[model samples]
Target: MDLSTVTATLASKSYDKVADICDNLMLQVATDGIGYHDDWPYAIHLLSHFYVNDINSARFLWKSIPSSIKENKPEVTAVWRIGQKLWLRDYAGVHEAIRGFDWSQELQGFVAAFSELYTKEMFQLLLSAYSTISIADAALFLGMNEDDATSYVQQQGWTVDSASRMLTVKKQPVVTEQKLDPSKLQRLTEYVFHLEH
Candidate 1:
């Protein structure tokens, strides 16, 4: 494995490329040597999966890790704690986990990227789930303070009632129409007709 490539990829913050790089290197090693990837950079590799929101792959990767490695490295476990929060859809816990862990320099960029994307996703969920929510709740949901949350909501075209301190969320228009592929539908129709005949 080329440590320099991994380092440069992490610095570049191309997380998907990082995943591809690490996974390909591990596959090459496994094919040539023992079938186990015991010496891989399990922490960053697991993080790359999370960065891409590939939760199932991250879970499998975590399980593949040797017990001794997990026991000795608290940072890896700390990274997995965030993954657990994400898996459980624990939004509040996700914020707490990010703040709660003492991340090494290597992991900080990916964790930050994950937090930003997660918050954006939660904002979209808020548009769907709530027409009105208190500033405090919005702050919690967006991982910002009340003041910053107020500004953020206002920037998104959400209006705040000063007396009530509640925000009226401006939701994106929902696409309700399900477009059927005409060719596929016709093929299925013909198949069913042939079967019946």
Candidate 2:
């Protein structure tokens, strides 16, 4: 397991690549089938799981980590706290855990990247799920101050009705691809053959 490569990947903020490297290296070199060895870059590996919004994978990784290692490394546990909060969809708690932890210099960038990605996904979800939402609720869901959330929604083209204090979401049109049905295609071909004959 090359710790330096994982460190470099973290600095690059390519979490998917980091995850692939970590998982592949763990499988090849990890002793005793534990998938983790001494000096493993577990924090980033764990964060990489969440970065892809794979909560189940993150939970599995947490379960695989040995109790002794987690006990010794407070950073691992602290980072896992963010995952737990995310599993429960506790946005406030997620932000709190991220801000509350004293992340190492190496991890600060990765954590910041995760925060930005998560916020973006949450904002999209809000836009799709709501026609109108209160600024206070948006702030809570986005982990932003009310004023910032107001400005952010406005920038996204959501109309702000000052008297109502509700941000009307500018929902993007859903464009579903039209998948051709095989049976219909077969019938059309048969009809065409008959007509030609």
Candidate 3:
């Protein structure tokens, strides 16, 4: 599929067709050294849209998610399951999957700042589920020693104990009363979760 067609399909929420087109686009970009900017590889990672509504289909499509993105972001994994729910038009399943997720604060912040900069709603959709990993998992994901991850999280104002407990978890439901600057927001969401790409 052509890039224009693929973009148009994604614009219309033709997610399955967009996925197929993206798969081909990635291969073409990889093999031919052509099309898109340097971030093309990262762009391809966005296509995985597995839906729990179609258990069999979800299982099949889940395999398409690239390892790099999957290892770093559990929300992406969850969102694919949401996509499966979207596929089957199972409103209840989608609700169940996204229950307890709160997008209000992040969405408000993003809309106040970045909504105009981005055309796609994917990041806005993802605002709720983004969270910092456990220190051990963060260490593993970052290929760092436990000490490093501890220091990093500490630097970000999180407290961790050697007993493997996150003593000061911040990704909980409460939004801070103070509004964050864009840099602080970037650190809190992007760096905290190692989703810097």
Q: What is the TM-score of each candidate against the true structure?
A: 0.80, 0.82, 0.31
Whole-model lDDT values for every prediction: 0.86, 0.85, 0.47
Give lDDT: candidate 3, residue 27: 78
How would you encode candidate 3's per-residue C-alpha lDDT over 1-197 as one tens digit per residue? 24676646645544445456655776786698674442332322332223102345445546655676667655555555545655675544544545423434322232222212221222222223344445655554333456875675566555666565543544436666986689888778967678646
Question: How many clashes does the backbone of model 3 have?
Answer: 4
RMSD of 3: 19.7
Top model number, TM-score: 2
Lowest summed-lDDT stretch of 10 residues in model 3? 111-120
Q: Model 2 scores what on Cα lDDT? A: 0.85
Error of 1 at 83 (Å): 0.8
What tens digits encode model 2's per-residue C-alpha lDDT throughout 47-158? 8888877778778888988888899999899889999999888987888889899999988988898888888988998987999999999998888899999998899999
Sorting all predicted structures by TM-score, with the top scorer first, yields 2, 1, 3
lDDT per residue as tens, model 1, 1-197: 45677888888877778877887877877777755444568889888887788899889989988898899888889888989988998887888888898888888888888788888988988988999999999999888889998999899999999999999999877779988999999999999999999
Query: In candidate 2, how many clashes are counted?
Result: 0
Clashes of each: 0, 0, 4
Query: Which of 2 and 3 is the better model by TM-score?
Result: 2
